[model samples]
Target chain A: MVSITEGKPLEHTLEQLSTTREVTILSCNTCAHYCGTGGRLAMDHLAFHLNNNGVTVVGKELVTKVCIQEQLRGCNHTKTIVLMACSSGLISAKEAWPDAVIVPTNSTLGIGSYDPDTGSATLLFPFPGHETSRGARFPSLNTEAIR
Target chain B: MIMTLRRLDYHALIAFLPRDARVLVWSCNTCARLCNGFGGKEATKALCSMLAEDGLEIVGGEVLSVSCFKSVIRKRLDRADLRMMAEKATHLIPLTCRTGVEMMRNELPWLEIVEVGETVGLGYLSESRGAVLTNSIVEMLDLPDEGIPLSEVAEDLGLFLGPFER
Candidate 1:
């Protein structure tokens, strides 16, 4: 039900997650897939982009539904998990695999064209929403912020 | 996972059904499952029920974990009950993406494979608003709102009890 538009540079995302070791990208094939942010086709393109950027993408997984606890259990032994899904999917992955370092691939510009800098929940078309820190918030992401 | 699915209209879907044609439903829990477009176990059951009510013979039905995966669908067809039913089934109605319909067709070359859901595009699901179809795919497919956009077919059937998991 949540909608997000993001256009963060792929170069930055690659530099953050693709470190010395292999990086595993968990592309949500469900919600985010529908949203065109992450899906099999998008993940494949991302992997292609990352590989071209000198990042070693060990694997790209199309998690059927990253929000589901059961599907979240498929995390690999790889150290990093790059998420292409929304915040809800990230939370589900965190709960399911507490040890894996998670990083979001996109920086949400906001629902529709609204900037996150102004704090207000936008409800359009009865879409379900996820609670997030508003006001141009950046998801805590760093190449060294691995857990 | 959430898939953006639209149902097929029943009137157009069954127009070519021959007399005494035995139908077996097959749906994928992949893209079709993501969208409420009649792509899961519940959809298959509901389709079978609707066909039965319409005086059609439904031999059997199953929700394949990945109907688009040719090998998996072949394995499903290899099941004793499914194989037996498929032997007698004259047609296969797949409530799945275009890939799924083709895979089913390849798997069973003799049976007539029917598509009940148009693979519009990849999509998202909101707990509050249900299925949301993105624009990229809509533009890619060049779909119009009228003239048998498959989901409307299932909507016309009006027997689905859904939002079930893949």
Candidate 2:
């Protein structure tokens, strides 16, 4: 099963990072990657956009699985972190770095099953309160994504 | 890891299938496996053996890396040997989480799918305490600060700890 999430609006993410001096972008390359929210490509794109918009992206860490608390411990020691993983990953980061300012860029929809042939994931079994999203297809973050 | 519990006992499971049922045992090797050996290669083998002893026609036993991926399940089902095995089967017994069982249903609509696992919530593997439930979609919302152990959660829910037993 895959943990599914949708990227927050670009404007909202930028606003959250507006006051930060230097921020680290932490992305998970597994389920989030499959969901097109948190991955190497997404991280790099976000970093580039942030840099172009006068924001200093100090670091970009692409963890294989950020939900694992141990794996999340290696994130850059920045004051602000723009986390691009699911809520579970965000919780792990919070537990790992209690003092750091963690900003989430994705909304956890729930768990899903991926279809490699279609390169898409369906929200088969949603988390609590996300029952309406069950059977919903993967979100298109392409609009919010910076080219 | 995704936490799951045995949804049916062996007796209940056997009685649910048709009299002339040809069974194909399917299992997931990831989260379900971590759930106290709930679903995995070994679990599949054990269930298959038990069914055979009960005089059921066991078509075959298959193990998936992650049954939650429809593509993975579909790819495996498309294989010539697997397709033949599936063709010979009337009912699919899945030793996987509910999501995995649902994917099997979507891919193989022709066969009657038998779900034996009930997915509870998501959890992480703990070095000292085993699998711990962190996010639950079910009733167990007030988990401990460090999260509740999957075994404890299963026990509290009146569910089986592992694979079906004969």
Candidate 3:
């Protein structure tokens, strides 16, 4: 299974994605859900934080099985849809709506062992193409951190 | 819909099984299949063959629609043939996520249901490699009960407690 840790902070992505336009957050309910990245609560957290910060969150969706392109089709086709899922989910969103600006909020990591006894996931081998860092855009509080 | 999985160290599974105890393996084609656990009929077949080579008698196995659904598994168990196989087998192994194991365990409390894979975290697979984890899981673990004290888990599983565990 794919086990990943959050890469970039939500504030960083929001700084770019929420700049003057309304943004929608697409959360994945499958692996992204299990990883705790794009689940309902995480998506809600992002939306709430962004909305509070003057970023108009136009839409918020929880996508099931984000990796499957078929499942990701026909989602919010607004100008910008902030993807709270993995690289695959981002790609699927992009594929489905080429015109819509799909921005990924989370950084993708590889699969590893997870001990519920501990709050950490052991990501030994990482999946290639996980360099989804949009680069350090804004020095801000880590809104999406699991604290 | 949360697809997370781990490859079972057939060695570890074998080490625990009683001598000559026949086994029945179950897998799902939903999330576990994507995580590389035996989630499909093909995967179940191949795993069965491999275990058979290891001197373990695998009676039969199946790849159901979703092994995590307790109702689904209960329905499958309703079939006389499946019920007979499960009853006859000494142990039942689920080549699925932890939830899938729970599904089997919930239905068949009397049978010894071994977990073939660890329910690590939830994520999807593009290739046959690693998957992406979610932020919600970390937040969930941040809660009191979900935290892994490492040492305690190690001690409970006897891993790094007195011996190196599988």
Candidate 4:
């Protein structure tokens, strides 16, 4: 997923937002981790990313499960919410706080299978309009062979 | 660093079985799904495959979310079509997580149970390098190999499942 800031692109969207606004990053510690995003470190990294960019991040929280309604009460109302969770999770969080401007830092990817080897979640499919980049060392298939 | 914890209760349930007992396998369709443990038909299939490979006869296999509910499980057991299979089996091996395992154990105190797979917990070890680690702990099992390339496995599984939108 990508983040937009003031109509300009930034290398790390979370860092960019922290720099531009008073931000309180909220993460759903459950499924986000499964999706390879969200957690204490992601929150800290984003905070640091923002700090380096001159954005002041006031606070953060790694809710046990953001999808659970009870945990929503723990969110602090100090600044705009930069949610580090799946799209479905963001919707739930938004419902809990109608006044907060909730911005999603990650895109909602589809169900992923766990690779016993890598411990990372690879998207089951390439997103629409996104071309899979061939590795530098791999031989490129000839167009003629395709035809 | 995949973190896995084997539920001790599950081990106890399995230990109750007689040596080389014929068993039926089942799994939950809920929490196990979220935990990445075997669930649904896939879970039942995996248990059958593993048990067969280990020289155990899997008399029958089924997948149900409420297998622990006595009324439900009992009704299935009483079915005329499954009477023979149920009679031949010495135990029921539910492939559910620790929670489901406990529920089943409470309802069927005499049934044998076994849980396989590990719970995976992940976190970043360092923010400076953006290094993440997954720790998996098996309840009563040890790894024969020092390390397994989990990233490759995750990648292959993702690709095998087909392309997904981010």
Better of 1 and 2 by DockQ: 2
**Each model's DockQ score:** 0.05, 0.36, 0.07, 0.03
Q: What ranges in model 4 sit over 4 Å off? A: A1-20, A125-147, B1-25, B28-166
Per-residue C-alpha lDDT of model 3 across residues B1-166, encoded as one tens digit per residue: 2444343455666788887889898887776665433367767887678778878888888778776545567778899999888888888877676666766777778879876564444333333223333322322233121223322332333322111122
Going through the candidates in the order shown, the clash numbers are 17, 0, 21, 25
* Weakest lDDT window of 10 consecutive positions for candidate 1 chain B: B140-149
* Candidate closer to the true structure by TM-score (higher is better), 1 or 3: 3
Ranking by TM-score: 2, 3, 1, 4
Candidate 2: CAPRI quality band: acceptable
Please say which candidate is ahead in TM-score: 2 or 4: 2
Worst 10 residues of 4 chain A by lDDT: A1-10
Which candidate gets the maximum DockQ versus the true structure? 2
Taking chain A by itself, what TM-score does each prediction score? 0.67, 0.91, 0.76, 0.68
* Model 2 segments more than 4 A misplaced: A14-19, A53-55, A68-80, A96-101, A125-135, A145-147, B10-21, B53-55, B139-147
Model 4 has a DockQ score of 0.03
For residues A1-147, write the lDDT of model 3, one tens digit per residue.
Answer: 344546366567756764566887888875566566768887787777777778788888777867665666566546888787765566546656678877787766654434333433445335445334222221113434422
Best of the two (2, 3) by TM-score = 2
**Model 3 CA lDDT for position A79:** 86
For model 4, residues B64-154, the per-residue Cα lDDT tens digits are 6544234555666677756676567778776654434555566555656655433332221121212121222222322222222233233
Best by TM-score: 2
Of the candidates numbered 1 and 3, which has the greater DockQ value?
3
